[model samples]
Structure formats: C-alpha cells, structure tokens
Target: MEWIFILFLLYTLIPVWRQQRIHIARYKTIRKLESNRGSRVITLIHRQESLSFLGIPFRSFINIEDSEQILRAIRLTPDNMPIDLILHTPGGLVLASEQIAVALQKHPAKVTVFVPHYAMSGGTMICLAADEIILDENAVLGPVDPQLGRFPAASILEVIKIKELEHISDDTLIMADIARKAIQQVKTFIKQLLLPKMDEQRAEQLSEILADGRWTHDYPITGEWLKEFGLSVRFGLPKEVYLLMELYPQSPSRRPTVQYIPIPYRVENNDK
Candidate 1:
C-alpha cells in the first residue's frame, strides 16, 4: 500500500518536474548564447492560447505580470552589459507597455529588440524605445493606435465628429470629447517613447502616422516600410533566435493536443 501511494505521487509530480527542468535548460541555453554574444538576453513571449485547457479565451501580451519579470531580468544583467530583448507579443495595456519601454530606455546598457514574428499595438510602442530594432524577414510591427474597448480611440472620435456634423446623437457628444482626449494622450505617450531615438519633429511625425488611425489597428508594417519611415530597422534572422523559437513552437490550433516525452535532464540539455 505504501509503495502504491509513492508510485502515484511520483506519477503526478514527474510531468511537472520535467516541465520545470526543460524551462531551466532553455534559460541556460539562452544565457550561454547571450554570453557568447557579449550581451544579456531577456524574452517577453506570450504563451500560445492553444496551451489553454479548453477553447476558452487567453491573453498573451505585455501586462502587469510582466512588469516584475522584466525588471527582475534587467536587474540580473550587469549595468554596462548590452541587453538583447526578444519580443513576441500581440500587445496589451498601454500603461504596461509604457512601463517596459521606459525601463529599457533608462537601462545603462544598449538595448536591441528582436521581433521574430510580430509586435502589434502597444508592443510596437515598446520597440520604439529600443536603440536598434531587428525583425525577421517576414516579421512585422503594427499601428500603435489606442483602442477604446473594442473600438479604436480615433475611430470613436471620428464617429462622434461625424454625428455632430450631421446633427445627431446630441446626448453622446460628451463621449466624443473623451475619445478625442484619449487619442491625443496616446499619441503623446508614443511620441515620448520615440524621443530617445529620433528628434521631436521625426518623433511627432512617426507617432502621428502610427496613432492617427490612418491604417487599420492590426495593419502590419514590414521592416522595409519601417526602415523607409526613418527607423533603424534591420532585417535578419539570428540563429539563436530560431533555436529559441523552436523550443516553444507556436501552436497551429486553438485547441492543440500536446504530448510530453520525458527525458533525463542530461539528455535534454543539448539546445544547439
């Protein structure tokens, strides 16, 4: 009876233990790569929604939880050492993104942001603070236009302005004023994030382009477009980056069936 109880406990804990060991091994691999490159690395990757138990909605973005994680990683890095940031996100709360952007900008070391797939909305805002932005050949950054609930802030204001012009929805006029202010606040915040990389003139120009609702909220801005727009965006793929991405491959479906094959930690240590 005692042996049976021990076996059941081991069976229950082995998977969790193996999963944690794999994570540690991955972190070690990344650290080795960064050491070889003469830099420290931090990753801000959103977990795939497919990892959820069911088809229930899950968010993978820069949020309050990531604030402490990013700061902890930064603290672990030496003050004079350069930092490589791997950013893979769909974006999230504006204040959350701003906090990260400011931290990266204030770091005593050079910060480079690598976008493997895409960084949209508030994610794009964070990249603006990077000294250098590297994107995979097919990666993209999207408009930084703020959203009011499910609608774009600028879009909300436009609707109100149109209503006023057509002399309708007098009761909703106050909402329009709030929307306009919200849009302006977002543009201002983005501009401040870009100030370290570009002058006020260029910052305002780029901020307006990203926040003016000229393009759809999710419109992809390719590396070429970003370079042409005056950003120092380079297009290239780092081998270590590809290796890291392979470790946590994106799920192809919302409900993915996953199997964990347990291996000795020594056998699983080869990340190259």
Candidate 2:
C-alpha cells in the first residue's frame, strides 16, 4: 500500500516539476524581451524555431503580440527619432501586421524596413508601407494574401454544407474566392492609410497584387519591381547604420553596417 502511494505521489510531482520548469523558461524569455526594448530602431526578425501553442511547439507563426511589443518599444523611444525596422518574417496575422504597418506610418519619424533574409505575406505588407525598404542581394519578399481564421473557415465550411444540401453548389469550390474577398478588405484598409502618400491607382494595384499574387514562398523581388510600382526607392543603407562604435560615439544599434542595401523609389510625375 505504501509503494502504491509513493508511486502516485511521484507521478503527480513529475508534472509539477515540468510546469515549474516551463514557467521559469517563460519568465526568462520575457525578461530578455524587456531588456531589449529601448533601442531607437527595432528589428522584427523571422522565427528561427517553431511557435508554441498551449505550450506545445509547432511551426512558428507571427505573434501579433510580439509585433505590438516591438511597436511599443518604438513608442517608448525618446523623442520619436527616425526608426529603422529590420524585418525577416515569413508573415503572420494580416490584421496584426497591418496594425504594425499603420503604427510605423503614423509615427512622426521616417520608417525604413531592412530585409536581410525574407519578408512574406503580412511581412511584405509592412515593408510596402515603409518610406524606404532596404534589402540585401539575398533578401526576398512575398505576397500579402490574408489567411482565414478558424471562425471564417468554419463559417465558409458551413455555407458549403448548406449549399450542398440545397443542391446549389458547383464543383468549382476554391479558397481563392475567400482569399479574394479578404484581399479586398485588406486592400481597402491599406489604401485608406496610404492613399495620402501615394497615387490612388498605384496603391490599388499594389494592394491587389499583394493580396492576390501567386508568389507564396521565396519570391525575391528585384529593385526594378519597386521602380515599376512607382515607389520612391533608393539604394544604400543610411550612413548611421554602418559607422562602428570605435568610429562613432553611439550605441551598436546606431552604428551603420554595409549589410543593408537600401531601396528608395522615385515618385512619378503622375504619382505626385
């Protein structure tokens, strides 16, 4: 009887020990995040590891909260000086992504996006809103089609079921229909925010392409794409990004590096 009791206690204690370990790990991560929140510019990099769901690891998805935290960091910056946003995400929540993009646009400082690896989906959207985008030769950008949440997907599935019951459905069912509508919604939101700074037609076209493009993965657009889009893209990283601490009397974040290749566009006569 004592052996049975001991075994049960051991089983209970094992789970408790795991939980405590997880808590400690999470605490450390939060502390690390807090420690790096005061830089003049913030880099939103891609997830090297998979994201967590209910404490279980899965493929890393964009955490809007993380992006918001970065935005909050920018807000906390003293005097709102120009902020360079380094990006390397595979994209996540479209709405959350847009929120970051909007914040970057509304902030009273120039926002630059530096893509060293790749920016996709919502990541690309954030890049589009930037006053300038800096890309290395190996960097890539992707389309901005909004993905469906559980609620939306369930609703659509229900509609399909009802349609099938009513004998009014066709064999041409595709998510593109849903994607198209989502694209329109995102495009409208983006246009409302960006139209003042861009031409109506150009903005609309960009919105459409971003929301409905075939390049889902590994689509590295060239500088010519920006030129064709009529954006004011330029070359070279800012001087401040490369100067080292020895040469410049500033923190490492302010020091300039040749790693970033800036892309600024020239506005067209009609765009103006």
Candidate 3:
C-alpha cells in the first residue's frame, strides 16, 4: 500500500516539477542578459499564481515576510553590483513596503525597477526608491494614499471634514481625526523615501501628489502620466520581462481565497 501511494504521488507531481524546471530556465535566461554588468535580478511580485496553493488564490501582498527575500538578495549580491527589481503587485502593508524601499535606497549599487504590469499603492512606494523606473505600456502605478483597513483614509477624512460642522456620528468623528494623522504620516514617509533621489522641494512635491489622496486607490497612472508628474519614468521593457510574466499568467478560474499547495516527498531508489 505504501509503494502504491508513493507511485500515485509521483505521478501527480511530475507535471508540476516539469513546469518548475521550465520557469527556472526562463529566469536563467533573464539573468544571463545582465551577467556582463554583474547585475542581480530580484523579483518581488505578488502574483496570484505564485502565492496560490492548488487552485485557490489569495490577495497578492508585499508583506513583512517579503523582507527576508529582499535581504537575502542584497546579501548575495556583491557590493556595487546593480540590481534589477521586477515588480508586479497590488500593494500590501505600508511598513513592509517601506522596509524594502529603504533597503533599495541604501544599496550601494544602482537599483532599477521594471514594471511589466501594475504596481499600485505600496508597490508604487517601492518604485520611488529605485534609481530609475522602467514601465511597460500596460503598466500602471497608483497613488500612495494610506488605507486604513479597507477604507481609503483620504476619502474618509474628506467626508468627515465636510460633515464636522453639522451633526455627525461619534464613530465618524474619531475615524476622521485618525485618518487626518495617517495621511500626514504617509505623506512624510514618502517625502523621506524620495529625498535620496531628488531634492527636498521636489521630494515633498511628489509625495503630496502621490499621498494626498487626490486620486482614488486604484487609479491607473500610466507611464506618460507618471512622467508628467516629474518621476524618472521610461517606457518599453525587455523581452525577458514579458516572458517571465508568462510563467505566472493570471487564471480566470482562480478566486480570492487561501491558496493550498501540495508537496510530494521524494521516493527512495530501490535499485540503489
């Protein structure tokens, strides 16, 4: 019965293993493209397929755990070697994003962000830390407005401020005040992050544009729009960038849920 079970597991895992090898080869090709520059390529994408288990897909987030990967990449790369960071995410925790951004800022070598797709909210924050940002035609970056729970702090505060003079609920009053402070904090942090690359005046200006909640959380600020906003933005990504996205193509069948992945143990070689 044990042997039969082992065989069944191996049969199921064969396809998955083969796919992994193919994807790895694709990454190797991308790395080879930058070998002459002694560049390190790190992908911090929050793709549904990458984070999913089985068929269920969870929200792609740049969370605390992601810091470990960034740190490892930094450690592995020699000093002064350029790093190409591939990003495709909907954003996650502010602090987690800040940690990664700061790491990139402090990195001795040049850091460039390649966005093959959208990198919104916290993801936009990370891109700001990059020395240069490369964007595909379809890629969109969102505002850095802080989100309190599911609510956009900017929107919440706007409503509360309007209703403050009139009769307003206690909950609204409390949340509005909290939102006001949160907005200021986000604005200040963004300015600090952008300071290394730009002057204080420009940094503060860009921070206000990104975090002042002028645009809604999901607004798709395209590459052209971003350039107008005074960011160092460029269009056109390498062929390898698109090829990499193929490895984790979005599945229409994948719903937002906890992903479950199955792992198979290695079978001993009886002949040995």
Candidate 4:
C-alpha cells in the first residue's frame, strides 16, 4: 500500500512539473522577443485552457478583461515607441475588439500585428487597425461581420427581406431589427480602422465587403487576397515569433492527432 501511494503521487505530480517548466520557458521567451523587437510586445493567444488538476477544458475568447489588460499595456508604452502585438485568436465580442483596435489605431508610432496562424472575426477587425500586418505565408484572417446568436446578423436581416411581414414571426422581426443595427455598427467600425491606410473610396469598399457577410463567418481570407486590397501585409513570420507561439499550446487532455518528425525534412538532389 505504501509503495502504491508513492507511485500514485508521482503520477499526479509529473504533469504539474511539466506545466511549471513550460511556464518558465514561456516567460523567458517572451522577454527575449521583447528585447529583440525594441517594442512593447503583447500577445493575444486564445487557446483552449485546461484545469491542471481536473483536466476539464474551457474555451477562451476576447472579452472585456482582454481589452482592459491590452489597453493598460498600450498605456504603459512610451509615446512614439513602436508596438508589436502577436495575435492568434478565433475572435470575440465587438465591444472588446473595437476597444483594442481603436487603441492600436490611435498610437502615435508604428503598430505591427503578427499573425502566425488565423485571426478571425473581431481578430480581423483588430488587425485592420494596425499600421502593418505580418503573417505566416499560410496564416489567414477572417471576415468582420457581426454574429447574432448562432446566425450571422446579415442572414437574420435577409429573412425579413425575403418573407412577407405577416409571415415573419415577432421574435424573428425583433432579431432582424437588431441584426440590421449590428451589421451597420460593425461596418462603420471596420471603415474607421481602414481610413488611415487607404483612400476613402477603397476603404469604404473594403469595409463593406468584409462586414457585409458576403462569405461565411469562418472564411479564411488569405494573405495573398489582402495584398489585392492594398493592405500592408508582409509574409514570412519571424522564427522567434514562432518559438513564442509554441509556448501557448492546446489542452493536453488528448493525444495530438497530427504528429511528424519535428525537424526539417529535405531530399538530396543527386545527379544520376
């Protein structure tokens, strides 16, 4: 029984030990990236976090707290000092996202956002406010249209348009009214972010295209597509930035579905 208890304790502590080591390594890497960039580095990474002891997973998204902390970080940055934000998220609340985006937009110095992976919805809205966006060649941004409950705001409004008023339910009519306002609000916010980067005509066009719900909410707006819109999008993410990302991993409850040799694989070109 004594031996069994000792073994059980070791099993329980191993994960905790690994967690602490990874946390320390993350802090060190963040500090190094800040030093290398000469800018205040902030990261907005929303990975599904798990309770250490319970092993229960929880989804994370941008909320008021995120806005408050990011705003504080921006406030601490010196005037005319560049800001570098490493962003990776599925996006979140319009109010929170707009608050962060406006702060980035109003900064006196250059603001750069690096997306190693995807930044969707409100994340894309925040990206638009940056002076420049650096993405991994395969990284993606998404549409900024508002979502009402489980449905897209634009889709909700469409039901009212295509159906007779007598046919439309009171609940749906109420949703349609709110949807119209939601679409308009998000469209206006996106336009404000783009105005500094392009002429009014192009900015208005791009904003409408993004917020008009022309595509599904999860559509991946590739980096190549962004350049066509004249947004300052640079490819080739920094190696250091990638290292920083490795620190914020997914919940460790399940075995990873994708795995391969971690090093570069190359075939020698032999003249035969």
Clash pairs (backbone) in predicted model 1? none
Error of 4 at 246 (Å): 1.5
Instruction: Give the candidates in order of lDDT, highest first.
Output: 4, 3, 1, 2
Backbone clash numbers for all candidates listed: 0, 16, 1, 0
Model 3 Cα lDDT, one tens digit per residue, 1-272: 99999987886787578668867887786676577446888887776553322445556688888977897888888777899988999998988898898888889889999999899999999998888999998889999898888788988887876774568888888888988898898899899887776779988888898898898899998889767757789988877777777666564463585556645579888985
Report the candidate with higher lDDT, 1 versus 3: 3
lDDT of 4 by residue, 39-133 (tens): 88898999875546566778988999999999999999997789999999999999999999999999998999999999999899999999999
Q: What TM-score, over all chains together, does every model reach?
A: 0.81, 0.59, 0.82, 0.94
lDDT scores of the candidates, listed in order: 0.81, 0.62, 0.83, 0.90
lDDT of 1 by residue, 1-272 (tens): 99999988887777567557658877877987787879988888875533333334455778888877888888888889998998888899888888888888888988999999999988898898888899999999999887877777777777765654667566456666777887788889888878766789988898899988999988998989878767788988677886677666454564767768754355456678
Q: For candidate 3, what's the RMSD? A: 10.4
lDDT winner among the candidates? Answer: 4
Candidate 4 Cα outliers beyond 4 Å, as residue runs: 1-12, 253-256
Point out the worst 10-residue segment of candidate 2 by lDDT.
Answer: 243-252
Worst ten in a row by lDDT for model 1: 49-58
TM-score of 1: 0.81
The residue-level lDDT of candidate 4 at 44 comes to: 96
